[model samples]
Target: MKVLAARRRDAEDIRFLIDHLGLTNAEQVLALCGKVFPEEEMPGRARLVLGDIFDDS
Candidate 1:
């Protein structure tokens, strides 16, 4: 899966979650959006969109 973070900080947070939390893939990391920002509101929510590099299918 692909993640679309608004800012560099958010990207860093996502990476941390993935590494520290032992998330298997991008999808899992995206699921922790709320956990990352529980109290404060997140201006721009990150998107976990997938992309295709080549048309192999």
Candidate 2:
């Protein structure tokens, strides 16, 4: 998947996150995806099913 989040954070040579501002969790991200791909709500659900990622995950 290629999520072009509004913000991103990385370390020395490692990527941390590619996330949207104010949408920090699974539910919020899912909702945003729903808007971007309304016809494929099923695929959006898959993203929700994938769960969340954190700074220390």
Candidate 3:
């Protein structure tokens, strides 16, 4: 349950990056995630979310 909620949050965060922040690609997502979550694994998770968005498109 926690994992599912986290995934949902990641998707929302990625949407914000793409829609509001104008981030449209993996490199942009990774770069922003690196800055926001420097010591965490969020960059990878963000990439997965971004990938899912790409797959959907």
Return the top candidate by TM-score.
3
Better of 1 and 3 by lDDT: 3
Please give the lDDT score at residue 37 for candidate 2. 72
Clash count per candidate: 0, 0, 0
Error of 1 at 5 (Å): 7.2
- Please write out the lDDT profile of model 2 over residues 1-57, one tens digit for every residue: 233232223221122322325445655655666687776534543442334343333
TM values, all candidates = 0.38, 0.43, 0.58
Point out the worst 10-residue segment of candidate 2 by lDDT. Answer: 6-15
The candidate that wins on lDDT is 3
Quote the positional error of residue 7 for candidate 2 in Å.
Answer: 20
Arrange candidates by TM-score, highest first: which order? 3, 2, 1
Better of 1 and 2 by lDDT: 1
Q: Which stretches of candidate 1 lie over 4 Å from their true place?
A: 1-5, 32-45, 48-57
- Model 2 alpha-carbon drift over 4 Å, by segment: 1-20, 44-52, 55-57
